[model samples]
Target: MRVMVALIATSATYLVMQVLRDEPEIALEMGGTYEDMLLQSTAHFSPLIPGHIWFRVPKTDARLRFIDTQYGFITPAARFFTVSFNDNVITNIRMSPQIEPLLLDDVLKVVLDLQDQWRANGWTVMYPRDNPPFADTPEWRAKLRDVNKGGITFWQAGDKYQVFLDMGRFRDSKRPNEERYLITLALAKPWLPTQVE
Candidate 1:
């Protein structure tokens, strides 16, 4: 009888753990809207010194470029990211890590982890090769030419948000050892249709 009760208690505990594990750690803020969270996060030119910031998109033209104030130049081998907004709505986000002698696999792992996080937050993810957006376009073709060397692309499709991840070298001047992974996320207002009617 005691054994049975203990077994049941353990089973209940396991079930509770599984349920909690499935829950998302970071809940969407700003009335639970993706656009709101994005806008808030990209509003300021917050330095990468400590914690990150989240806020609504800003009005007018704004750009955040990290520079070494003491050295009077841009930081070397540091991650760089830019966000662009259209009419106070998020249009683009680009993130690029510093190029160094790091292992390609290690760099890719970091990007993949980010992809997984976005996926967990309910973003539909796809590999570009599997679902090419502009496969026939000359520009896409040119970009694909160098995709053999660890270049990859991911596209997220949805009316609420669209994201693109272009990893590896797609530029002519980029060296083989340089890591130029870029992640771009765009969000269109719910009232506005992305497709022209």
Candidate 2:
């Protein structure tokens, strides 16, 4: 009985590891179906509302967490990681970090990292005329806020798809008076607008 139990435990551990393998880089690619998302990540997604589903990155020590959401030492950087679907096809992916008062430097880094990933997958920066070496100053932040009303930056792949990075105001439902800022990254098809709301 002891030997049989040990064998079963080993098999279960291996199965869980195989299921939780890191595949978020490809998983976030646009135009996949819900089943494709499930097959790729094998992470459990909770329904945020009617059309949206949310998931967090699983911790390294925890078998239940997905591999994409982990930060340093079990901290989850992504707080609101949601996927929106329209008619069973994934329309967009949205994610915000757990930290509040999103800093301009950190937000720019995230956007640049995302841009790097998109470039690997055949996308290119199409706007702003210049690439980063972005100055993170009080004046620069204020200028960004002033010029881009929606606080959004985007890249395009041919005429096919677009990726948007938004650093926008977010209000907590539980704390109505407190306003927080967050960076949200979204991937969408041409028909869907990545609106900041």
Candidate 3:
């Protein structure tokens, strides 16, 4: 009975690892990608509704948050959803929530579900191995490495889409704890003109 239970446990762990290792397939399309859906939402809805659209932190205040000038809207600060645009083009989309402790399996499941949804909607999703660097400090790098080991997926559609799971230390004056877990699903189009740094 002990051996049988061990086998089952091992099998389940292996199955999850395999699922995480496999790359999501991609399909090419001219228009109507996830990017388009976000742009449409931003144009049609109001940011006042937390889920409908992401609010832009005006340029004056955005600099204070260390947000790039090109980015009109800041990444969701709490458990909220938002999409960002650059020159009328969809640039970023994010869904983030605060959790007590970051769970790798939970984060992976969320990213996979999002990938499946976009694929179902006729978007080509590619899980790329390379991710743009974001960490600077040794401590930050160590934390990021730990997260990456649990399996991080960087899904992209050409140069226009980027979907990934990431976490960071939240800095909000109202929130008591600045450190929180974040799961980000971001999209970007490199061709669009951006503000000079």
On lDDT, the leading prediction is 2
Name the runs in model 3 displaced over 4 angstroms. Answer: 1-78, 86-90, 97-105, 118-151, 158-160, 167-181, 190-197
State every prediction's TM-score relative to the real structure: 0.39, 0.52, 0.35
In model 2, which residue pairs have backbone atoms overlapping below 3 Å? 57-69, 58-65, 58-66
Model 3, residue pairs in steric clash = 27-124
After superposing candidate 2, which stretches have Cα over 4 Å from the reference?
1-28, 47-77, 97-101, 129-139, 142-150, 168-181, 192-197
lDDT of 3 at 149: 38
In order, the Cα lDDT scores of the candidates are 0.40, 0.51, 0.39
Candidate 1 local Cα displacement, residue 1, angstroms: 34
**Residue 117 deviation, candidate 1, in Å?**
0.8
Task: Summarize candidate 1's per-residue lDDT along 1-197 as a digit string, tens digits.
Answer: 99999999999999998955543221122123334543433333432222233333223223322211221111112234444444443344444433332344454454555555555554454543454433334564355445574344443434544444454544434465554433332222233333421
Q: Point out where model 1 deviates above 4 Å.
A: 1-78, 87-89, 97-101, 127-149, 169-197
Please rank every candidate by lDDT, starting with the best.
2, 1, 3
Q: Which ten residues in a row have the lowest lDDT in candidate 1?
A: 67-76
